[model samples]
Target: MTTNDEARGEHDAPSSRDPQDTDADEYRTTDQHEATSPIDRRDYLRTVGAVGVLGVMGGLAGSATGSAAAQADWETEADRRIAEHRQGSLEVEVVDETGQPVPNADVDVEMAEHDYGFGYVLSANLLLNETEPGHPYRETLKEDFNIVWFGNYHKWRFFEENQEIADQATAWAKDNGLDIRGHVCLWANVDAWAVPGDVVDAMGVDHQSGESGADLDPQHVRDRSFEHVREIIEHYADFEYEGTEYGSVIEEWEVMNEVVHVPGMIRAVNGVPGEQESDDLDPVTAPVLAEWYDHARDVAPEDVGLATNDYNTMEGSLEYARSAYERQIEFLAENGSLDYAGIQSHFGDRDSAVSPEETLDVLDRYAQHGVRLRVTEYDATGDDWSDEEKADFFHDYLKTVFSHDATDAFLVAGGSDAHHWRDDAPFFYEDWTPKPAYHVYQDLVFDEWWTEASGTTDDSGTYATDAFLGVHEVTITVGGESTTEQVSVTDASGTTDLVVTPGTSTSDCEEQGGVQVGEHCARDPDDDSLYEDVNGDGQTTHGDVNALFENLDSDDIQGNADAFDFDGNGRIGFSDVISLLRDI
Candidate 1:
């Protein structure tokens, strides 16, 4: 077996230098790192103080900051970066249908979803099949996160056997309004578990001897790989189920995984020319890898993002991993085949913990490559560490990554111990109860970073506020009339202008011993009416109540609370479901 040291190189050993010694200036710089305008450092400081970063940083004694001043400096810089990169001004205008300004209108802005992806690994099997035991997993994912990638069902081996399950999960995700990123089109690891045995047999080359059989055809290997890529990409790009076409639900696909560590397919395509030595290293700019990416680009939709994913690049210790990743990124970027540089930020038990400052330094180094960065598979699984220690690390690390301008998304490798590859690494315990890390995740992603504001429109019929970049629902209420519209806030300084006409109340539907729900009248369950069938099962049934119960906390139920207020309450709650159940 090839040792990691040998696969990298003798001189390219892990770095032992202190993170403070590593300067961002030493690497290539980009405009993304520079502040576009002056930021209020005091505001950032106050924000951090209110959020209690001091408590999160308390256990981080070995952090890059040696003194209180250094700690404060790091915190200020992080907050400043977040303010400079993540926020934008939102301006909403309310007007009549005749284009007249409706002054003094009440406006409420609530964030629907983040444009920046915050996600975790998902289990398709458990998600679709397991019910009571998996309720927390499903509900937490639906409520707390906005994106997901299947844990194993999307891999080549598992995908071959469970394509139906994977498709069902994809459909479910689309229905739930969650973004799905393709985990991998190909995993280049030489292990049998990664690459199917038939593919290895098709290669017809002995990995040990590097000897090729008569069936050794390089073109055939390329064709087979390309076929798989094309099939997976095209199928998901326009996935269809039950007469609904979920067009391009998956927007990103990892074209190749772990190319540096194991270049087995690269070797297979190169004709397996010589004896396979454990210590032999492949060229950093392997032509076959580039060819694979080019093929993927051709097969994928124009808007879909393609990435090269690998491990150890962001750990702040493995110099070889960093160097190899940088070279691969350079090669791919020059070839115009790279959209994202995937950083599998897995901090294992034995690996040295990278401080927040060091993590920033790592991001700075990769940001210079000009490709968007993603913390694709992040986990800090230290078995010996206490829960508080884990939580502290998660809090500090998420803030640091989310603060950086180069990073486009941050995804945990797994969220619950029940489905995690490493048992100790998940944010939740096996019983689906939250660990401290889970609370940290929630506090940062939802509470602190989220945006919600309300104000009355002035003479110009406008209400404006600076908010974090994302899709927000804006509701304009004039007198007792209200209208809601979703607006996308995409840029830091760019203004998202939304014009909404106030909607008037109307009771047009004919009531039949039932309540008026939205524009339609919902009759009693015994009438078996077509109205208010929440599950869309063609008629009212007990299943509709079950469906409403399952999605009580979801955005859909809360957004349309008035329509589903079966209990005649002003708000959506469990009592509404109980009332609906009793009616049935």
Candidate 2:
């Protein structure tokens, strides 16, 4: 039996070295010396083709073909790891409403969502304010991602002013069946950009250099920090909107961001008695940072996760940063305050991109700290590479990240170039049209990793198959009748027994021969005038045309192509919206 360590090491010898067997410096630089470059487009395609992303049901097509053979082996091993870690056996037992086993029922299982988080950063303003582009953005977010974090709105400076923005965004996310991860309760950087200007002044720290002043009071700084943490966590824990409590939708919160890179809070609390030349110049004790976690844990909900987020530990060659981050993780683990160790994977240019093997190696080193791992902020940027190259690299990177057992979530920094911090660093163009990378995301998250299995139940009325862990919709057809139930396949040993009565699972649209329009089902597909009620209003008016125009490229319209394909091209487009407008 291969363990996670052995599985991670199958690719190369350098990644196989156990950190306990080697000194700190040796382990940190084990694979750091390799000349990492952007993935070759042709090579990447060849590698993926050689072995499917998950490799759950196949072997090498051919044997012993030199470098191709080696690549194939690597991919197979990666897929093996993914299957072992990400998938679980799902057994569905079908029974009638009377609690009797139904014999020979046809069962179909389709995955509804992934247990692992695949998410991206979102702009609260874009999600709440814009109409022309906002509708598509929100639709794409709901369709493509299961989790989200605000780009800037959740920060102290931004949240202080526009608390309603975060509230509304959280409400929207809950309504759309999406999860929210709070970006940060506190950023250790004492700059006005991260903290409020008045708070910076009160801390008496230099905004530019993070140096302490004569008025610096350690207790005051700690008090202010603790207050902010309490306020942020408590407000979100029971977030109330309209008449519902949506705060529980936010499942995780970053207690501190960039702890190692921006150690101002750490220095302030420790009373480091010197003018710090650089943020990394002096190493403060890990317990000083762990205190922040302890305070957050005191105020945060028990189920909500509290994390320590930092960058450069996984991607860059900053040995000091890596060592410091590990120290913090170790201390937090010992104190039982850290729920997750967040790695911000911001890759730039081809030369700086970390290889797949190296990524596993870094993750292995940190996994020893015994904390859940997450790729909190991931983005790759290169001015010289073509869109195809970027997409290829993203595909490989996402696959590597998802295959690891220690990593639980992978969140891209941005989804569209228009809202991204860096130009050309997202999956879509400015107009929300998909780039090659966006298709890669869809193919993996929705196709390769998604589970769809069907079979006829035996006399015992049970059908079983290995499925990816997530929520799956099960449909059982027996006696010329069909019933559907949603089941969660959470673990390998779990059996989700569902009892259904036939003819009870039919949706309104199925019974009426109508189609889903937005959140409502169209009542009359044959009535041309009623079909024009795109907004679900009683009359066909200009508002319906506006609704169609706003959601031109949205998934709601595209998924209902049969009803919205007015131009007869078998797809939804501006021409269809124009036709609807003309009719109205």
Candidate 3:
């Protein structure tokens, strides 16, 4: 147990250094040819910004590397890079409280954050631990958290595997104080050809002349979809899994998975190509989404939140930024299915990873709707990055997640390294021993952040201390006649003190947006302001700079003059206009 000294002053929260400021900046690789050279694969990885999340549905089965735009510049660039390859590297410097290097002392540190709960996706083996009396995995699971995303317990697993596991797992979570979020009701039709292949195939309605399929009726498919919702909610809601009345164990459901990229969905259903518009709600996409939401809400009991989960929402992909976030917010706002915005955060090895500030901005964007947010399926991926780098990224990502009030939960997509979906998962190697990320998780969750401490009275007859903000149980022992007090530690300005009447028995407490439809929130779109693409040519070029100059001082600006306001002078004058050109 890592304990803080009550007499001493408070230490800095977890990481003293910025997540981006690691000392591994100058290192260059000499063994460039050592990386297995795949020309096309390497290129596609770079081209499609975040390919790591595409395989989210496949579990350990990997996903394809290509994007919707088939083979193009990504391939050409990869061809160039693969001609002379260089392996990327990652490193982490472990230091002690005194600012000296610590050489491997088997450290287990924990720092607690806010009400935003941390959880993991329970693999089948991990789920099996629910029945175990005292297994190591079970102990670890319970020790860290009681919640889990029941891995592969979807419609397919419901048919193929023993239903006992689902029952027992859910019962265990309820029996324990964990909240369960059921993954999805409808995965993309392209993703539905697995064990529950028959079920998914049966729901297929041919879009031959905007009518139902010859094999399956549209009404029948709709009925089955509704029934599927009813069954899942009812089974978990009313039935007991392991001889325990498992009432209301499931707190939320991800009504639909990734409909944002389902091919020809908008064209076939709504009479508009999915790629044609910047709009999320066209005629076709709207009804299907509405049905899923209606079915889930009608079947589920009250207070059970419904969310439409998707990937690349916060991965900073331009396509997703246009197609996914803005449109989903508009639709959810209309339907009230906006209980939680589920953004899957995953990393690809070849591309640059997302920053903490970028992710927080995404959170702020979604919080504009007043909907709770969850880091739905999270994995810090990439074989190119060292284990330490992954840990560092996870550390920073989580720090931002916990600090935000709008966030409700942050759940990892997999449990163990051996059972992860992508090869570039939490850790590189396959061993049960905890990795650096694991240790970071522990140190943050248990040691530094958790609220639990006890010490004898100081010379001042008081224990002056600080801790995380939460409802806490404090005790004062005066010669075996222990007096316990219930207190809430929530002082925003500084350390909150808990005191007694006679003397100062002080306990310290640690202190811790609107959405736009097509454009950036709060940005006036009379001009194309965000990308500095003033010319509307889809590319930022010299043309844009010329367009800015031509339209200067005139009320009728040619493009988004505001985006080119580089000098922050609040106007598109020469200084601001020329600055964007020079920077470009």
Best-matching candidate per lDDT: 1
How big is the positional error of residue 26 in model 1, measured in Å on the Cα after superposition?
36
Give the root-mean-square deviation of each candidate in angstroms. Answer: 13.2, 14.4, 25.0
Clashing pairs in 2: none
Per the 3 Å backbone cut-off, how many clashing residue pairs does candidate 2 have? 0
TM-score of each: 0.73, 0.72, 0.57
Enumerate residue pairs that collide in model 1: none
**lDDT of model 1 at residue 443?**
64
Q: Please give, for residues 290-358, the per-residue lDDT of candidate 2 as tens digits.
A: 677888888887788888787677764557667888887887788898788888776655554666777
Cα lDDT for residue 559, model 3?
A: 42
TM-score of 2: 0.72
Question: Local error of candidate 1 at 180, Å?
Answer: 1.5
lDDT of 3 by residue, 217-328 (tens): 3454455556777777777655554443334556688776655544233223344422345455553246667767877888887767888666566653435343556577
Model 1, range 1-584, lDDT digits (tens) per residue?
A: 12252111101211332211211111111111111222222343345543565476465554433466776777788889898899999888887757788889999988766778998766675566553333666776677777887765666655665677778888878666577888778864423233444565545544321223324556666777888888888888767777654456686998877777756566667776212333444645878788878988998878889987777787637787888889999999999999999887766642445777888888888888789998877776656667766666676678899999998899876535544555554566666566767767766766678787999999988889988887676778877867665566777978767766676233322322434333222334444432255543224544455456566677666866666777664777655654564454
Give, for candidate 3, the lowest lDDT window spanning 10 residues. Answer: 1-10
